[model samples]
Target: MTTATIAKPWYREFWPWFLMAGPFLAMVGCFITIYFAFTQFSNQPIQEEGLVKRGLVIEQQGAGAARQAAVQSKP
Candidate 1:
């Protein structure tokens, strides 16, 4: 006995659409992220002197953290 197979078009299949859903959602997410990055995030110009100022602030913070650590270690 021989069997007969029925052929169907690609669009009528479920797997193609199922596989495409992930990439479609990813592309949509990327577009939304880009929109927010341009509109919501800040565009700042940092001056050369600002680098020194930032470094000084970070150094002071590190010194404070070190003092805290030293005090904690005394116990």
Candidate 2:
């Protein structure tokens, strides 16, 4: 009887190459995507005036004046 040789897979054969390559490819892809995003962002600059900035602005009208007004305005 002849002994059969085990055939390795393409991925298995390429495992070390993939091990070194996978992260490198991912990093390159990430940088490319980031560059594209930044380029698009820079190309179309955001309009500060058009955007609806949702928040609150509490100006102290004046504590003494506010107190006087509250007292005067009370029914």
Candidate 3:
């Protein structure tokens, strides 16, 4: 006994596969783009360690000022 398969109509055929796969492929492309962006950020050389340390110091000083303000605000 031999079996024959029925062919699907053209409009019903490959379009659904594209719709299903399109978003998945687009997401993968987006992931690749984000990965390259992060890599670029990581690759840039920080020219001055002193500048980085000063930034940290400024952040800490700002946090300390906020704490002082909160303490002074309490009755």
Q: Where does model 2 exceed 4 Å of error?
A: 1-14, 43-75
Q: List TM-score per model, in order.
A: 0.51, 0.36, 0.35
Which regions in candidate 1 have their CA more than 4 angstroms from the true location?
1-3, 44-75
Candidate 1 lDDT over residue span 29-58, tens digit each: 999999998887536433352242342352
TM-score, structure 2 vs. true: 0.36
Report the Cα lDDT for residue 41, model 3.
Answer: 70
Higher-TM-score candidate among 1 and 3? 1
Q: Please state the error at residue 10 of candidate 3 in Å.
A: 12
Worst 10 residues of 2 by lDDT: 52-61
Query: Per-residue lDDT tens digits of candidate 3, residues 1-75?
Result: 999999987778888888879899999999999999888776553445233333335222445677899999999
Worst 10 residues of 3 by lDDT: 51-60
* Error at 58, model 2, angstroms: 16
Candidate 3 has an lDDT of 0.70
